[model samples]
Target: MNIPTRSAIFLSLLFHRTVLSLQPPAPRAIVVGAGPVGIAASLVLASRHGYDVTLLESSPETSIQTKYDPTKAFLYNVNARGQTLTKMFPNLHDKLVKRSVESKGFADATITVVPADPNLPIPKSSKLEKSFEMRNNENNEAGNAMPKSEKAVGVGYWIPRHEMVGLMVECIDEHNEKGEGGKISFYTGKECTSVSPRDVGGVFVEVYQADLVVGADGMNSKVRECLSHPRSAVGGWSLDCPKPNYFKLKKWRSPASFLRIKVLQLPPQFEIPDAEGNPPLITNSENIYAIRSIYKGPRNYLSLGLLPMKNNTAVRATNIVTRPDHEVWKLKDGNAIQTWFEKAFPRMNFNGMISNEEWDRFARAEGTRFPHCQYSRGMAVWDENGDSGVALVGDAIHAFPPDIGQGVNAGLMDVVCLDRALSGLDTVTGKEAKSAKENDKPSLGKNLARYQKQHSPEIASLIRLARFGAPYQYRQPHRADRILRTLWTLNVAMRLILNKITFNLVPPTCIILSQRPELTFRQVMRKADLTTLFLKVVVFGLIGLRFRPRLEILSMLKP
Candidate 1:
């Protein structure tokens, strides 16, 4: 029989206490919404950031959407920002790259852009095609645009949105398999009914507890409602966001209703034509075509998009219908409406423009749906206070029409920036531990404030840019839109002239997403504005040079 000595027992207990002290506490993180951004944030926090992650989904599956046409699929555009995020998660990126459709070859040529009035003296559709290309710097501007070591200002990828969600879930599963980060617990179909602060933990969701709560839910997010709603004495916790910061935010919605009609691939005969009238655009290849239809008046407009499936002949057809100051229209009776489709796009392939029959079929297959997007100013990627253990990402904060195809791209960027912010926080709490004493509670809230300040200006600029870019895609009855559209026309004309004169003009400062990965959204906007202003000034100088006598007389007559 062996009995431990009192000294041995005392030494053992002391050693155990020391070991526990040395080990850092695994941060408890709960992510609401298992959508694309939610899943990505979950994996990164668990695997890369080493947080104990819990992912919750309201739906039974990541996406409950069921496709009516076996050939058709949902799609998304992953831009430079999204690509930057992909680089952070190698496994996620690798899987997506393998199965995804690459869009390097896509250009303005893929789509036809015509003036609303055919006789409006605009260039040929070929010349007016808009391509999503990253901008190169005129000088230090280009240098400033590239973030990190990523040098190329490359075009984004166009993969199905559902595929993105599915693949993200798979990547997260794989990360969980390795058990690298604090063990991740994922639950789907279990809705997050309520969220409040716990006495013991920082945040509480239903029965689970966590140090932080990240809400990546989409536009209609319940989690966002909780964050937005004022806390009550009985039910919710107060989020002490400063009053001054509240005034900085501008919230507004486009009252206009939009109708989105999606159809499976065009029949064999209805192929998207190229400039030369070659075989259909999606005949046997995997190229996508995005075209904006020209309407005769300011009342209505449409955007047509065709994306190919990776391994199948089926192409996804999307039609976005916009009429100024109108309510969302629906087709429920399965009545055929081929007349308008034929009139607008007589040259295209198989079926008529979204036939009522097809629309009804889709409605039956999926549920009744309407795509609505609203804009709010000064919404950074993260919520106000990180110390509150609450943060929001993706459509929860800012959701807008895909004017520049940045809906998901912006969301993905949110995760990337948040990841960086958290990484810095980890350093401060560990390697920068001594420095934490200088700033009390230096971990989440302080780093989140840094994120808020650093990222707010850029996201605000993006929101404004999206609003400005809206007229080109959607018809606007507002007088302001009319004026902006006129200015936009002038900008486009000046751009053409400058490119003609300089032999190499900088990319138009349209305030769209940058091609270079490094530049902030605000940086891109500033460069675009500068380019626009330069072009305008140059054009004015040219006018004076050509009409010197008239200008001199006019200047002398001015009172």
Candidate 2:
């Protein structure tokens, strides 16, 4: 029976190979965003899947035309997970690194613990700070003649979002010049107002019809809104809908996960010193300094984190993130905010670092909040005939605070996953295509569903992990809060050590461990939950032991 079955399978495969490959017509895709995720999605669809793409951006053409916009620019730490997309496109990783601050010589970090008294001198530098300084100085002296091994040790790249988008656009233009797989037509200031999931679903940027509509637009996505508040049916047709529609998506809203952020732009080559007020040994771009205070007062001191931009000319963008109701947010004017900065971070030379104009700018800047983390149940919804569909990618489907820095990386991975899910159609022969057509089974709808299934769980795990796992500590003014955070961190470290010593008997949680590129977020979450249970059991056992002695003593007294 096995021999006959194998023979039959071989004969079927041989017959299929003998048939001529019939390429299907390229499907038209309308991607409704020109941000990093949307642009990358366009590249994948056009180059890999041979889909003619129309890229629509709501921002006017002038905004992205410049090399960089300091006021609006923020740095993205593109780690290995986000860099995985480079494998699909040639030389993209190199291009990104060339324009970014590479991790090897430029990614050193220094932390200074400030004294309680504003008049008191800054504390001495720790061993970690000394080592960072040494390495940075060595790199500077060596200049561009660094070793290949050292260069290969780069953990990631720190690139501004606008610059990354510019690089992607360059890739698109190059692909166009060489006549790559499919052509992409880019249009700026074309906002997507509505969508109709009727026959050959259309995106109403300008009433353009397409086989598929991709919602790569940002958090305030119009496509997501369209899905949530679909046109109501009336008299056998949707009056609200500019046209008739068959598919009505179940209304869904993202779970609210909010964090307010204020961005401060500091000048390039600014002199920032150590806790002892000593000038840094290396250029500012090579290191990130965090100035924290020791005082536990009514109002928490500002915990300023300054992340660098590109190597030479880029200015530093400092983020002052806090709860929406934090005391810092209550400061009404620039003078009040400047006073807070001067009081909160005393060791730093604020006079030399930030000018009066800069303070005013920071005050005038209106901070933004992180969007809720959610994915639509109908991420890949289609019409009744299954011939046309709408798919969502990037922030349109899932978003959260950029606390973990996986926001952009996860969005890029979505495009790669979508491409993998739909790649199965390339093997369909003419006979199979005709059979699929006759049977009313277009593979596009099925493939999109497959993508949703494969991608949704990761999205869920990512959101949960980002929202709850190893949150960044801002070192509040309360000593109790600091003590508890320290204990929690030590406990995590202890579990990791135990797992190593006990030969995996005690599984370690994925707190900071979630950043490992080899492990998926789902895998990370599973390990985290299991480790949590193990710790709980150990804690209960210890409690039982401690009480057992007391109980025995009490029994003796009773006797």
- Model 2 TM-score (2 dp): 0.76
Per-prediction RMSD in angstroms?
8.6, 11.5
Worst 10 residues of 2 by lDDT: 142-151
Residue 232 Cα positional deviation in candidate 1, in Å, after optimal superposition: 6.5
lDDT of 2: 0.64
lDDT of 2 by residue, 301-325 (tens): 4566665566655677777766565
Model 1, 68-186: lDDT tens digits are: 33323556767667877787888778877876766542333243332223233322233112332121121111111212211225655667766777788777778778878777788
TM-score, per-candidate, Cα-based? 0.70, 0.76
Task: Pick the lDDT winner.
Answer: 2
Give me the overall lDDT of model 1: 0.57
* Native-structure RMSD, model 2: 11.5
Q: Give the TM-score of candidate 1.
A: 0.70
